[model samples]
Target: MNSKDFTAGLAELRGLRDEIKTLRKQLAKLETARDKQITALAAYEKAKAERIAPAAGVSVADVVALAPTLAPPAPPQPQEEPAPTPQAATNAAGRPEPTGVPAPDLRRAPGKPAATGTAPDTTITGGSDAPPAVGTPSSHPGPGRQPTTTPAADGEQPEQVRELPSIPPGQDGDTWFTATPNLTSTRPNFTQQPRQMAFLDATTGVLVHRDTTTRLNLGTGSVADILIAVYATVPATVERIYITAGDPWHRDAERYPFLRDAVAAWLNGPLPDGWKIESTRGRDRLAGHLVHPRNPVGRWQRGDQHTEIRSVGEWFDPDGATPATVRDAFVLLWRALHRHWPDVTLMGSPSQTGRDLWSRTIPTKAGAKWADGYPVMSEEIRGLLHATAGQGRTELITPPKVPDRLPQLIELDRTFAYAKHTWASGVGIPRRITAAAFAALSEKDQINALFAPSHWHIRVTIPHDWNHVGLLPAPAAGDRTWHYPAEPGRTFTTWAGGAEVNLALRNPHTPWKVEILDGLLWEAGSPLREWSTRLKDAWASLRAIAATHGDPKQRTAAHLASRAVRAILLYGIGAFAQRPRITTGTVPTGAEHDIPTGAQIIGTDGHTITWQRDTGFARDPYAHPEWAAGVWSAARAALLSTKMREDNLFVGALHLPPGSVVAFRTDAIYTTTDPAWPYHGHPGDYLKKGHLPGPVTGPRTEDELLSLQTLGRAHLAEEQEHHR
Candidate 1:
């Protein structure tokens, strides 16, 4: 087959190879386009599934049935022309500048069917004729108008714009100032904000208004000057005016009188018709009220009003100086009397005129007579003079006897005695005297008295050899705290005229001491004149009793009896009564242990009796029931048979007030064994051991007890009277 045939076939085979390569390249291009279409269809199916899955609850049959009537997708429309750009504006520097216009939104193209659920652009722009953005917030939007816009010109880019929420008028807007009104019924609306300034007026109530801008400097002005300026503002409204005064203002009014005169002048002066100035006398700044003359009948009544001319500064200083003129006079008189009584030896050497003269003696034919200066004493002295005149070498040196002046002397003596007692007790004037003084003085006067000076004579005594005694540190100036050491045997003396002693005694720490010394000291010019009189009378009566009671034994016996009765009544009864309790065993619970009637149970002392149902009588009168009734009867008879008489002994004339409970030790036989008992070996032998003494026998009920007490007191008073 030859070389020529082989070469021609090889050329033809090369041409066929080139044609096959071209066909293969075209098939590869078609496959690539087909792959692209397949990917697009897959994405579309996925999206469709996602949208339908939310409504999967719908039956598939219903979906298929509706599918036949469903419209096919709309064909894609043509794209619209791009927004036209405006001509560029030239700036002062000759550079092309933006027209401040906004470009159209490319997010929603013109021809592409709008996607469902896509948000509409509500952005605003600068063009007046542009349609309003689809969802622009507007109270009233015009139809067919696009949002105004200013598009960028050729070769220019638009500036970035920020969307802001629109705020309607009347709602809060973005601004620096906000207004809020507090006044509901009334309002004072000013074009511009007003500056607040207080206005002072006398007669008007609080009034607010805004008109004038006159501002006065009141910082350095006098009250009167400020008031005048305020009044000069004439018809101006006022909120309030403050009035105040200090100590000096009242002092000036009191001392100078001209200050008050000036005030009266101001009140009567010509002022605004409606202006009425109310002034407080002192530091009280409360608004003053003027009640109508006929308030109950009047239609309108005046209310509290602020003062215009108010003084606020302090004026006077307090005067703490104490006066001692009366005390000095007393001391002088006392010294003079001491000198006058140079011959008087007894009764402590008469260092003071107020010392008692009872101990003073005058030599007489009858031996000696007391210089008490009683009216009856004068007659005795005359008789003594008559008897001694005839006796040779008989020189009767009689002490001066002025019966008429005895009352004053006695009063002085009593006062000094009280003062001495007060000093000794380490307490100032007693509470009784203080109460009497308080009852007589007004509240204001009492306050004044607290600050007022009164005479005081305090003597502080320490141990003789102990030299540690010294004045306590002075209290801080104006501090009223006071301390007085109440150590035993210490005497305090405060002789100057001041309330310091009283203040110290009145403190809570000193109440007991005050009570102990009550009615001992008298304040100068105090209203307790009755105390002095009563004390003087009592002293005179006592002295007279001493003079008349010649039998010392009888007097001694009576005194002893009186003291015994007082001891039994006060100490035995008021301090020793004990409640009965079962002894030696727990209280019996069963009825088998019958407590016998009249069974004695021992008490501390005294015959007061009490019964315990389980423990028997606490203080039985007798060991045997039969003897109990007889003993009790006898005691009652003995008490009842006794009559109230001058000779009967009792406690002092002072009787215990009614309803006072007298606690006493009940006399009973102690069954408990005691080592000290005389019948210690015989535990039941109460009589041999000697039972406690019984209480006073007569009184039964509280009333009867009180009656007996009254009788005893009367007897005491009678004895005192008889002696006097």
Candidate 2:
């Protein structure tokens, strides 16, 4: 507050004031320059815009009219045209008028300023430089607004440039477009046409055009005609068409048209002979449209019931008529379309396998040219064999010839018989016969020999009762029972029973002929002979056995007795008893006139053997004790003949079959004198009684004999079975 402080403060204040004045002056000058530069820049931009707008096919009026709507709206006026308010602007139509129009009030009222211009402090939409002038309504007045006109002054419209339709979300660019490099409004653009097929006759070489909906008519004239007809008739697009022709079965390559050359090559590849072909057809429909005149734009819709036939039958049946024809038409169609659109789906019957049958034969005359040598199979022919024959071995057609001989002839006969048997069995003989079947037969002999043909016929009839006793006559009048012949230079010794004989022989050149030996040798080592001889030998053997240990006279008696017993057993007599012996004592005796004229004693005492149901000797031992004593004495003498106990006994002639034993007893006798004679009598007693005996034991009663024979055979069979 002191005067000195006041004065100092005043001086400082005056200095500050002078500095403020100078700074203020500099700031004012800078502001004026900036304002001028901004005004000049705005003018330059406006001029540049006017110049560029028309060059770009836009006018200044259009540019200005389309300028950024950066300016704000003015105050609203009364609904009524304020009767030419003195200060308001007016048009030539006399609406309103104004002398000074406020310069667009560049200072924005508030908030954000116009985006069209840039101040050093503001962010411009197009950075500091303006964007190229776009069309806009002009500030000056314009007229004649048309509804479809662009926003240009004077309504001079700019041509409309439309954007191409957007591609369907994603697809190949050219899928919907045709390759038209020279396209123009005046020229008609073209697109690819659909592919079509033309079927051709395999036989007559006629082409058939089959469109989407038409069947290939047999009457089709030419490939071109068919194509035109199909194009005119089908309800589908037509792009490509062609004809095919050929006989697929035949090997001639010149038969098919140009398009089918490749197909023919594939089908006619090498194949063996003796193969037959078969093709099965399908009834499935195609998977494309079929629009005929009656059914325009009809689609070949897929359905469960697929039934349609478009291709000709010749494609499968080349002859179109016969069942014997072989063909591969499917392959033809496949090759024709494979190069183009293989994905074009085909609908038809389920697939089936095809077969080819081919056979080749050389005549017998042709075979004769080879001199009966094995004909070698050609490798070329083998290469063409059916595909299934990969595993078969190549072989000659004919067999080599064998040398002539009896044994070889027998073998040839046997072979012929076998072949004939096979033929009778109904099995098909192969086309080519192999040589091995009758390798032993000479080819020349086969070709020229008088080898007679014979057929086998076997007739068998079994009796209703197996136990029935009956005679089986010999097959022929002179044919006797079979006898096994002993091998030459062999010796045999029979068992005491005389049923079997043991033999020893050496075989050098051949196998033992068992079949012949079995029947030939009744006993081992016995010589083979006629049945009569066999009977005689048998009788002699029995006599020798009887006399082995008996009195001289009684030995003879025993031999006779044995012979009688054997005859009885062979004749199958069941019963008999003692009969008188007549030593020619009753011939024409004084009592002989007492007998009936036709009746006479067939047997008698002494010289004649006799048998009776009851034991009564003409010379009774009681009436004549001496005679009885003599009889007993004679019997004792006869009973003494035997070396072995079994020899004296009634042992079976042969061993029993397996699992059995022969039974006999020396005490047993075949004589009528024996107490059991009536029940168990031999043939001797029946002869003495003047009656002929039946078969030995009658059917099953004599089965023991068969068992005996089988027993002997069984032992022999054991060795043979082991060898087998």
Candidate 3:
């Protein structure tokens, strides 16, 4: 308890204090180490979850193939087997590199583990056998190996050699490409990852392909050349290319023949070796020629304004300079004919229009009759003929006695100016024709109308100003589309193709339906040439009738009546009556030779035609209810052929041999429980039979329409189901 004890105790207290200080220091160091471990664990978990999982999913094959191109890690050779210092390493390209091992500062340690698993692999280093360090290229190749190539030091690709992702056939998706902005990143000196873009291909979906510099360059020249080059370069295994048909430059099917031809040639002929080509046309390219003509000529007016009209034989004669030589001459003559003598009769078959007479000296009937010599008519005669033969002339001209038979000399005058505006007159033969008639014809009688030529060109718009007048063989009871052979002592039945009639019906307010019917009838004959003479006579007679009944309402009624008369005519032409008498032997002079029993002709005025019939004759065999059922059955069969889609009757015509006529025979009054049925009775029935069913005569309630409603719903549901 003395000084010695005190000193010893003080020394013990000092030693205890030193020991406490040392213990505190050790505890602090341990806590720092624990915090670092926690951080490193957190970072490892994040890297595993986000980056590693996604990259791993890329097929091992794809990853390995791309491996050699990846950046290599810095050297980590051990110094005397010293512990590995986990410092952030730099890639060979001097960019900040991934550490492979999660750093203590970045990751937090977990409190506990559900279970301990295998330790992580950390064998990565600069040596060739090391595991691929983060950002470093793998030493060993993986599956689906791609050719290895060195990347540019600047991280910028040469624009051409950069391998783009292979676009999988039939599959559309975003594509990645090296972008310019990332090419030269100075701070990180890192290559920009591929930029995502929508690549467009005709074969591709709505997603578009990015336009790379190479693609742009390929498109720089003539479209045809570019297409050809592209086709040559592409592997032949590719069946077709994805292009833009809607591209503004190549939209018109008519104008870009070269481009289209190039595409076809590429598909069929110019493909690369080790590959075969197929076009979008699929397997039947030849059958598609009709749909896509190689070099389609446009409407008549589209060609040289004046085509040197020359005979097919004369233009091609060995000694002849030919049509091409006389192109300008023919052009001048055409301008002369079209501008000055627009009404001069045209020559050649129907469909050629006026092209046949371009360079030829065609003699008008009057000109030929009045010719002084073999030249037909001289320039002096032409002068005397007046400067413009097409316009109205009131000089005294004798009307030739109503011809016993019409001569086939013809000319078509096109002056249809009133085809658009509403008409002032109530006369409704289609408002446009009414307007044209009023404007072209004088109050007294003369009216301007279409004249048929022996030959003429058919064009999209040419039909607008012309009428086709040629003989078609009359149709028989069984024959609906084609004209039948005329035979004596047999009754004829007339029918029309549903398509033609429907086409005529396109105009909502057309009034010339009846007239069209009549015209159709007069032309019915075997071999177009057979009906030419008779057709002329009929046309002249009709014209006379039209002039006679010029009153609008009367004309309208006459037009309707005329349709029936034409139908009867068609029947006669199809039967053994008038058609046989004219076509079989010689053309008939008048009605006396081959009179029809069912109907009697009363008048021949163009505006109104009269016919007398018993009105109670039994229905034609083709018009019987059984016939209707057969037609419906046929339609159903055809629907089956189209996979249940209702197709046009013309499409079915392929089943028929060439020259076989086709028609869709259906009741004009197509009323049924189904509301979709257009009419309640036949169009011809009311006129011919004088009555119709009464269900259509009365007002009906909405609830009473259950039958039609159910049918329509069923039909629609079927359609939807089929689509699905």
Candidate 4:
């Protein structure tokens, strides 16, 4: 071989080796891209199967059918133009610029088919109108079109979805907003209650508006607001969201009504234009949140100090509370429980504790609890109930009973030190029997006879022209939440929108010249009378449970029983018994107040009433609702109304000195020092039940006593500062 040929061949061989090395480098880059595509695909599949696809399901029962193919429309044909460069696809921050929901990535890998769910390829691809490989980006339409992976169901139109634009500078809320990890990246799904959060979707950096027939109004606020608190902004894309997160803040419902109410409000998504928003109630905005999302469940410190849940090892540490205790609590709040806004599953349900205890129905006395024999309403009257709704138009809530100054309460620094003395357990249940107990019995004999069911019950009315002038002194003008006025026989809060009538307030010595406007009797007239049998049955069940169970279990049973009692008393019976009035006929004693019932009693109240002259099924007020069965349901007319009676009559009677009560809970009083309370809470002091004693109970240990005192002191100081 010639020397020149050898030199040339050697040079060519070296060049070929370099080329081989370069090819290896290219191969490494392609492999890396393939791995990324695989990861992204897995993540997307996980999100879809668990979050997106299931979310797209029509009902909780259809989670499996929604995989791979779902409600979104088929992918549009790929754009003919060359793919955009990396710089063109993203903004200054390097995050992809928004185009449309799940836009296609047109940049393709040189050899491999584009994997499902890979991030958009940013390299340029030559202009090609033809479809790319079956799984590649060239097959999908331009970025402006909606998702293309799934086609819409037959005859169904895929609704266009849009994100909430960032609040404009003019409407921008608190820029310094903070978020707690309550609900993270979750929203409700179809067929599941947005409120129950049963079925959920990821909180798209914005919520997607589904073009579905179901008209659900997702109220204002998003679970992503938690991100705003964490990152000061939502993640740039849905891929960053994970809906399976458990509650980062384990606060329960009743203790955290703000969160509970907020969850309820936010489930409907943002409020539409003209939704009635009481700006003061809580509408003041903080970024995307309506109010300060404070945590209600505080962390327990080294000891038992309750404070914010920021303590170390708080959520992970096992709470020492027994499972039975937790179960009981769950039963009580089963109505408000939620770990799902997206991360979803069934958590709990009511057990047999209640059903078994109250299994036996207590038969009503007098042969017929009401001699009227539970008359059924006609279809016409029932239609009126369906149209007008068996509900009242009036409702009001009692204001806080606290005094502006808590100087005395703060000074005492006693935590539940004073025993709370309420009326006898039977006070709300007690009443003298009537001749209706047995129609054949004489009225005089009925009043003195043993307690029994009755067809006739007293209904008192207050005239339109009445005020607390000479007799009962009303609470301060500014305070409308309270209206007990220390009058006996007034077991419930007086009507906030009308003249209060306590027939017991009538001067027995100077009785009014009453008129029997309706000589006719009402069926089981008084709610108190109507509910007596049910109420007694519940109490009996509670007693039976206590007798059956041992400690802790017995205690929990009693508590559950008490909850039922409260539910019946405040909600069930309270609804039906509202607004019973009697004509405040001429008071010969010349007393200046005429407490009456009906339309006249509501004259010149704070609210303005518009009288509707319409008639027939749509306008009738006397209609009975279908839900109102014998003793199973309360009248719908009263269901929507919420009236807060002072659980302690002492509040209205002015028993405690001004500013002496720190906090008033269910049946306990928190004060800095004792206020000469009726029950000194000595050992063995038990609950007061008139002459008979109740279960002996109080702070079990000195530590408990001290803890209460400390909590009361801190709360008093905090409340005082807030008031200031």
Question: Which numbered prediction scores highest in lDDT against the true structure?
Answer: 4
Tell me the alpha-carbon RMSD of every candidate. 56.2, 66.2, 43.5, 36.6
Global Cα lDDT for candidate 4? 0.25
Candidate with top TM-score is 4
What lDDT would candidate 2 get against the real structure? 0.22
Q: Give me the displacement of residue 450 in model 1, in angstroms.
A: 17
Q: Write the per-residue lDDT of candidate 1 for residues 1-724, one digit (tens) a residue.
A: 7999999999999888778767766775875665454334335533332223235433222221122111122222224533322321322233332211111122222222111100112101011211222222212111111112222111122232111111111112111111111211111121211112232222222211233334444332333444556545634334223222121112223432344332322222333344543433322122232111111000111133233332211110111111121112222222322343333221111111111221121112221111112111112212221211111010111112111111110000001112111110111111111222322333343333323222222222222221111121111112212222223223222121122222222211111111110111222221112222332343333334334567654333233222222222122111111123232111122422454554432211121221123332233110111111111211111111111122222111011111111211111211111112122111011122121122334333446434544454455456557999
Worst 10-residue lDDT window, candidate 3 = 419-428
Q: What would the TM-scores of all predictions be? A: 0.15, 0.12, 0.15, 0.26
What lDDT would candidate 1 get against the real structure? Answer: 0.23
Candidate number with the higher TM-score (2 or 3): 3
- Kindly report which residue stretches of model 3 are placed more than 4 angstroms away from their true locations once superposed: 1-295, 298-323, 338-472, 476-481, 495-724
Poorly placed runs, candidate 2 (over 4 Å): 1-233, 237-315, 321-724
Query: Candidate 1: deviation at residue 193, Å?
Result: 24
CA displacement after TM-score superposition, residue 141 of candidate 1 (Å) = 99
> Candidate 1 versus the native: TM-score?
0.15
Q: Answer with 3 or 4, whichever has the higher lDDT.
A: 4
> What digit string (tens of lDDT, one per residue) describes model 3 on residues 444-512?
211011210000100011112112110112211221223222111111111222112222112111111
lDDT against the true structure, per candidate, is 0.23, 0.22, 0.22, 0.25
